[model samples]
Structure formats: structure tokens, C-alpha cells
Target: MLEVTLREYGPAVSVPLSSEVGRALAASGILQSATPDPVRDGHWLLRAGSRVGAVRTPGGPVVRVMPKTSVRRLFFLLGFSLDPARAWRDSREGTVDTGAYDDVVPALAHAVERQIDAALRQGVLQGYREVEESALVVRGRLRESEQIRRHFGRTPPVEIAYDAYTVDTAENRILRAAADRLLRLPGVPGLVRRRLAHQRVRLADALPLVRGQELPRWQPSRLNSRYQPALRLAEAVLRGASPEHRPAGSGPLAVDGFLLDMNKLFEDFVTVALREALREHGLTARLQDRHHLDTAGLVGMRPDLVVRTGDGRIPLAVVDAKYKVEKADGLLNADLYQALAYATVLGLREAHLVYAAGRQPERFHEVHGTTAGPDGRGVRLYQHSLDLSREPDQLLLALRQIAGRLAGATHDRDHEIPVR
Candidate 1:
């Protein structure tokens, strides 16, 4: 029997595999690192080369493939399944391993259900019972049969053994939804293809249902279409996928990635995603510079992007793009002072600040001229933000709203909202 030990127990419980156990769980194309593939156990095949256990001549430890998993890893794997769209989008950072889907997903339906069943008896899953019955009067009855008014009641409802404190709780719906989609994708190859499709294929969706069918080796529209179709339009790309081909919008829409800069650490992503996202949005974008250049004078200035749409009418729009999980004093202030400096030199009417949208569309406007600068310049500060929690199409509208405000009064609001 495999000895189960708890590695962590606060927010969620985790189990670490001993060398003997880690050796027993090995597979290809899933977990390439030294870390164990906690996502899949069927990849549970032992690595005879690594462990200190007695084995027969045939490299035999009789590794009876545990054909199943416990709730510990089942829910854990389910957690990966939740929001797989976001998961896969983030997977490039090495945050996600292929094992969870390739090896673990198949064995789960049978094993995971049983594990949940076992837990049902202990905690969250125990069912309640309610019974209604009639009662008769006894002790105080005045001789003979006496009428009685009494009743008993019990209500039964099923429960689930849930760890409310687990990350699972924070991501329960996400896990359930992702798991459901994975379960349903077995017969829907097209859906999976679409999910994994390339931008050209999606952009070409209107052109032809030819992604898997054949390549348009010589299709003219491939080079002519103004819109770049999406492989899988997701939260990460919701704003980027906005299909407006205007003077401000037209160009080869690209999915700029730090693919070569992939990092396992989560914080590493914040900077890369922020800068790349800013550039992709046509904000003040700067690519990697190799030479040891001097930024002394530019250390703490403002206006990441400056574009003047009209002829010599303030030749640029000063913009600063900010990326953060949450905004605090340090965050907004950074943009504020930066914009202040930019406005001073450029002589622009206003500066636009942008931030990523989280759960909803939120905005904060800051007025700078409230306090006088050393030289007494009329400094006005404002901050605007977008909530990206809405659908992709809606996010586009939000971006349009920002682009409109920056475009200096040409944005139209009369059209009805697009139903898409």
C-alpha cells in the first residue's frame, strides 16, 4: 500500500512523493521537470532507476497501477481543469504541465468519483433525513381513547464533503466548469480544434471551414483580410481580439509572447505580460534592448505612449499603461507623477492612463493641477481604467471607449451595443 502523508493542510492539503513513490510515478511528455506530476497518477508508473526499493530481475516492484486516485489529487487535478482556457493560456510559463490533461484526465472519471464517494461518508457529503409521522396522546388522557395533536418532521438533503478553505473553494466553479468541458470534449474534435486553432484559422473561419480540411495554399484573402481570426479567443486576448479595422486599428494583429522568456515563477509574468500587452494595444511599447544604455534622465518620467492624431495639433497623446493584480498607493502614484512630467514637456492637453480589467469595468480619474509644481505649470492628472470581466465583445467596446477618449472627440456612442 502507498503510504499517504500530508504535505500541506491549511488552504489545501498536498502530498509529497517520496523518492520511492516518485519513482513509481513517471511518464513521458507530461512532467519534464524534476518535480512530480501531481496532476496525474496513472503516469503513476514507477521509475525503477530512481528509488531505493527491492525489485525483481524484471525491474519488477509489481507496480500495481493504482487504477484510481484519492480526493487529494483528484480535486487538485480538477483545479487544473477549471478555467483550462486561462490555464492553457498561462501554461507557456511552465505554470501548467501537460500531464494533467494527457495522462490524468482519462483515469479520473472512474477514480475521482469513487474518491469523492468515500469523502461523502465523512464530512460535506453526508445526506440529511426528514421524516413526518403522527403521534398519539398517552399519559394525560382522561380514560378511554383520547384525541391527540402531534407531529414529527425531518428534512433530508444531500451534502458534499468539501474543504471550504481549499483553493478548490476559491476556484470551485472554475474547476467544475473546466472538468465538464473536458468530459464533453471527447466527441467534439472540432471544438477542441477550434480551441487550439491558430489566429489565421479563426480569422479564416469566415473564409472557409478549412482549418483541418486543407491549407489555402494560394488563397488571396489570407493575405488581404484585415481582421486576424483567433485560435481561441480568451480572457487574456479578449481586448486584443477586438476586430475593428480603423485608422487606429488596422495592421497585422499579432499575439506577442514572451515564449522565449518563459519563467516558472508567477511574478516574472507580471512585467512581461504588462509590457507586451501595452505594446500590442499600441501604447508606449519598447522591445528588449541589449546594449548597456543610459536611462538616467528617463528614470522616473511619464507618458509611455504619445500619439498626435491631427496635423501638428499637439502631435501626440501621452499614455501610460499599468499592469497589476490590484492597485494601491505605489501603483497609481507611479503613473500620476510620470504623466505629470510628460504633460509638462510635450505641452499636451491631457494624458491617458490605462490598466488591466479584472472582474468588472472600473475607472479612477486623478486631477494633477490641484497642487502647483516648482515652475507653476498648469498640471492636470487623470486616471482611467477598464473592467475586463465582461465578455470579449464587451471588452472591445471598453477599449473603443478608451481609444475614443484618446482619439480627441471622434468616438461615437449612438450605435446600439453589439449583441455578440
Candidate 2:
């Protein structure tokens, strides 16, 4: 798979695939530049100046820039230029392109701060502070000379120990620019704010590198993958409502259902919803039992979904839908290998390994060419995830992206677009 090793902690963790790794890089703010890995491997491959896995994606250049988070929370900490990815690139061309990316973390931080201030003003999360004024006792000395002993008198207490609620010494520690404000920091790109299992908004790791020392301190944001899951997202929303909590005996996080059959979990409503989403985009796909060639004495393979544009149409793409969370990005490697095998069978030049974004958003991947196709044509791999939770606008946009790519490739890579 994608061998990801840290530059400093290179031996601590070498993951094959991960989205958490991407978030970590964003928070570190050490990389000079960030891009996707040029090689094909299971890991969410990312590359930077002497740094790899800086912003890893499933299979394309669009890496997961932030952790899985909530709409309301992200609304406060982040802002997209309608199509930030496209607009960010257009910023240099002209008038503050909305579709262009500025990824100015500080700008988003200010926007978030304003949103939070508005919310607070509206009593969304309001708190009151009280400070009481009290008189202070001052020590004074009477005349010590014998001749002035009779002149000893209590001097008016001078203004000592002054205190005011409006004025503070360490104001920055208690109140400073919010994350939205800090996001304006030149290097800060996208910021995601979410609470952790500890019921606290993760400010930063316990050992935050600050002031040339690793100190436990507050930060503009945090980097955590556990809170990036659906269950965690749910908990963040339904907090304070002690609805039936999952018992500890429930065991570790796993596929929703495993008592009956493991693979059957992919046949549930979630999977169906995903396929429906693809179809709504004008792409027809369905799950069917398709067996790979089984040399009489050899093994064979089975795919969850054998999708095609239509009959008489060489399958334009092979897709394998996954239901795991972003943390389980490792499981994706096997899926990629399986999909590639399917592409080989149908003589397809590309295959899409799709994922269902339970609580996260869609992660875009660039279209890349890999091994040769059945006809000795170059085979490419693409990765995409459907944001089941996003509005229709997102789905439409995603559909347009795929259609545009296909239309573009026809002219240069092929004579004409395929017709089913």
C-alpha cells in the first residue's frame, strides 16, 4: 500500500492509508507545499517538499484537508467560496474569485468568530460574568519621633490594589481572536472544529508545541479522527440528551451489523442510497453477483457491485462501494485491488471505488492512469465518495465534474465518447 512515515517520528507509525494523516499535516503547518502522491498505492497518498502524506486522498489529488465535522460547527469555523477548490485557483486571475481558493485560515477564522458572536448574541451559548468591587485595607506608619508622637494620625487610605473587570493583564490568554480570526494566519488553510469524546472542543493535543516548548495549551483547532466519524458526529449533535447510550459491552467500532453475515451489511439501505445517488446523477449502476475467472484449480473473486453504463456498452467504470468510516481507510486497499481486477475483465480504462460519506463530506480525487487496459490501453484509477448528507447542489456539482472529465478525455484519449 502507501507507505506513510513521519519525518521526525518516521518509525512510530507507518500507515498504508489514512485520512487522519492528512489532518495532522494541516494542523502541523510545517510543510512548504502540499500535493498528492504521484505513485499508486493503497494509502491516501500525499506528498510535499520532502514530506509525504501531507494531505493524502483516496486516489486523487484532492486530499482530505480537514477532519470529519458538523455543519453547524463548520459553519462557524469555515467558509467555502461556493466552489473553493476552483475559486482558490482563480484568486490570482482576477476579482477575488468565489470559486477560487484563498484557504486563508485566518479569514475563515474571523468569519467563524463573527458567526459565533452572532450566535452568542442570540443566546445560542451565552454566559454572564460578574465582578464585585470591594474596599482594601492599607497599612500606614505613625510618626516615630518623640516630638511628633502627638501628631500621629491615620492618613487617608490611598488608592491601592486597583481592579477593574474591563481591564485585564493577561487578556490574550482568556480572550483573544477566535479560531476564525486565527485562521487568517498566512499558512492556515481550512479549519475544522469539533468536540471530542471527552465532551470538550479539542483545542489542541496535550503536548502542543508552543513558544519553543511542548506545552498543554489551547490552539485554534485540533486534529482527531475518532471525532470525525458518524457516531461521534451524532454524539456532538445529540449531546446533553442522554438518549440510550451504546453500552460499553457493544465492543469496538465496527460495521453496523455483524451477527448475521459480514458482507450483507453492504446490502442495506445505506448502500442502496449510495447507488441511487449515482443513478440520480444519470449514471446507472446496480449490485450483481459477478464471478471472476476461476482457473479450475485456482481461486476466484467476487465484487459487491458490477456497474455499467448499459448493455452493448463496454463498462465505462467499475465501482465498489464501501461503508466504513474514514479511519478505516486501510480497508480501501483491498477494494482498489478488487476493482482493478474487475476493470481488467471488462477492458475498461478506469474504475471508481466509491465510499459513502456517513458524516464526512465528499473527497475529490484526480483521474490517474495506471496499468494498461485489456486492449493494452492505459488503465486509470479514480476514487470518489458520495456525501449522502450534502444537499442536491453538491450531487449535481459532482455529476458535472465526472461528465466534464469524460467529455474531455474523449477528444484526446479516444475518438469519441462512448454511447451505451
Candidate 3:
């Protein structure tokens, strides 16, 4: 077995790799580009973008992309995005061992195992699940239509459906599925694997989910409150991994890996946090609010967020979140153009753009307009940056301040009713 390591959005590194491995990795969506080394034969140069995770190429090296942020912060973002209300409780109580700094795969496996263990401390969750089957004896209810159609008025075997109180419920199935996935992934620590196996045994009665099928959905409630944190993490594990892919003729490359796109993660965290913050000020926020740039409606756009009144009848401000750094030239032209379009379409005087605050600080660009008067007809595009490295409370506070600014925007729009 061979192994390769890289950093997210880091400089390209030359690694000894066979053509087979290089091709597999390039297509894996892990590397931004994998090119054959100009001078070194049988080697390739690989660079990663914002994606971070470990990918095991069949009969090749396991390529891992480590994140730029610390493992603890990464977990915080993931947890907060998954369930904002309960993330604080889970973070305080849950014990997640994010091993050595570079060991992301092992860290996630360990974290998941610990969460699952904590969830099952009392016992496996059981609920009434509707089951449909053909049996010799009637159960909770008889499927008259099914019996008539399948049996054609025959006796003995009967089609019936019943609600069976058992452990094979959606919540348990998700747990088992996540554990099963972790067990198959490469780089998981042995101790973590053993613990996950034990957890699987506890959930043995719960059927294994079919790969490529939609996971069973479970709603959170007081009855299963203990399982909420574990369930959220498990679902993230099951949903975040890359699907298996086999190139044109290469013998089925078994690519088993879980990756989190930092771009999408940052956007989700910012929008969700802002939405939560707005509740305090009686404002509502919509993620990916849809609108048309032109009257034809053919040119459609979805802003990352649109803050509105509590009733959602009015649009207060438009916001977009960017995960990348600011360009040397200035605010990214494309981002500025897109923000302008959002403001123009929504007919709002103010729009906001949020960026990860590493490369630049917070600022605003007042777009040029002829009627820049006291009426506030000019569109003010505010650029806010959230330092992901800041403490969780501080990060939330930044969003709260942004929420306050958004709340203030409402006053300016009090008299003006923009075209919806």
C-alpha cells in the first residue's frame, strides 16, 4: 500500500505516482490538477483546491488533502451548520478526539465513533416503523387492494402492512450506514474501527442501507433527543463522501473517501448563522433566495441570502458569501457585478457580501449612481469578513452585528415598496 499527502489550496507538490494513480486522482475531484512531472518520469504534480479529505485509489496510493484550518474549528463549522441550536450542547458535552493535526480521516472516524457511542449509551433507539409484506397471518392491517391484485382472491398467503415497534428505524439505519461507511474507508484508526464495529453490532438488527440509495429520513423530537447530535454527524458522513467512480476501462477503482467542500461549508455557516441572529431582531432570512435579473425571467439568480421581515412579505437586504480571498486588484469584479445584479433585481438599495476574513478586512463599495441623494437611491454594497479562526462566540457576535446592520436597513426602506 502507498500513501500521498497534500494541503488544501496549497502549492502543488511533486510525488512519485504511476499514470494509473495520477489519472484516477485527477478524476476524483480531490485535486485541482494532476500533471505528469516535466523532469521526473513516473511522477506527477498535484494541487488541491478547497476540498479536504482522504481518497484511496484502488491498487494505488491513498491521497489525502488536509484542511488549512485546525481540525477543531472545522468540526465546529460542521456541527454548527448541521444543527445550530444543539451544536453548543454537543460541543460542550461530546468528546471527539481529532488525532494528530494532519490526520483528518482518522479524526473524523474517531469523532463519529465517540458520538455514536454516546448516543447508544442508554440503548438503541426503537420506533414504530411501517412494514409491508406478504404473510400467512394477518397483522395490523390488510392491504385489500394488494391482496385482490396479487393473489387474485387466493387464500393462505396474504398481503399485509403493519407498524412494527423495532430498532430497524430510520435513526438507527442512518447510524449503521454511517458506521458501515467509516469501517470501509481507509486510514481510520484501529481503536476507532473496533469501537465502530461494536456500535454496528448494537445496531445489527437495523438493516444496512443500499449504496447509492437515498437515506431514510428522521425528524428530531424529544423522544430521540439524545440521538440528534449523532444523527446529524452520521448523516453528514454518509452524504459527504464521494461516490464510487471507475474510469473507462480501469478495473473498478474503489474510491472510498469523505470530503467537505470548504466553499459550500463557509456559505452555509454564514447564512445559517445570520438567519439565527436575525431572529433576535424579528427579521427573517432566506438562503438562496431566487429572483430574475431581467423582465424575461429567463435570467434567474439565487442570492446566497435575503433578509426580510418576520412575515417574509418584504425583502430587506441581499447577501452573498465568498470563501476565497480578496483579489489583489480590489473586490472581485465578478462578485461585485453579481451583487449589483442581486440589488437591481430585488430593487433594494443595500446589498451585502460576506467573505472569509483572512486576506482582507471589512469594507464597503458605494456603486456609482447619478441620483446619490438623501433619498438613499444609491446601492450601498457592504463587504463584511468573518474570521473563521475567531472563537465560536466571537464569530456569532460578528454575525449578530451584521444582523443588526441588516435590521437597520429596514428603516431606510420603510417608505419605499420595491417591485417584487
User: Could you say which candidate leads in lDDT?
Assistant: 3
Q: Clash totals for all models, in order? A: 23, 19, 0
Name the 10 consecutive residues with the lowest summed lDDT in model 3. 411-420
The weakest ten consecutive residues by lDDT in model 1 span: 256-265
Q: Between 2 and 3, whose TM-score is larger?
A: 3
Q: Could you list the CA RMSD of all candidates, in the order they appear?
A: 26.3, 21.2, 4.2
Give the whole-model CA lDDT for all candidates, comma-separated. 0.31, 0.34, 0.81
Tens digits of per-residue lDDT for model 2, 151-248: 34534332233333331112121222233123322223332332111111222221112322221222222321111121221221122111111223
Pairing residues by index, what is the TM-score of model 3? 0.92
Candidate 3 stretches greater than 4 Å from native = 88-102, 246-251, 358-360, 373-377, 409-420
Task: Please provide TM-scores, in order, for all candidate models, with all chains considered together.
Answer: 0.31, 0.28, 0.92
Candidate 3 structure lDDT: 0.81
lDDT of 3 at 353: 87
Reference-based lDDT, residue 268, model 3:
88
lDDT of 3 by residue, 1-420 (tens): 777788998999888887887888777666788899998999899998988888777677787888888777787788788888865455443234465544677888888888888899999988999999999998889999999999985795899999999999999999999899889888888888999999999999999999889989898899899998888889888886445656655666655677888898899888998898899899899999878888998988999999999999999889999998776546788998998889888878878889887344456677776246476656777777888778777777778778888888333434332321
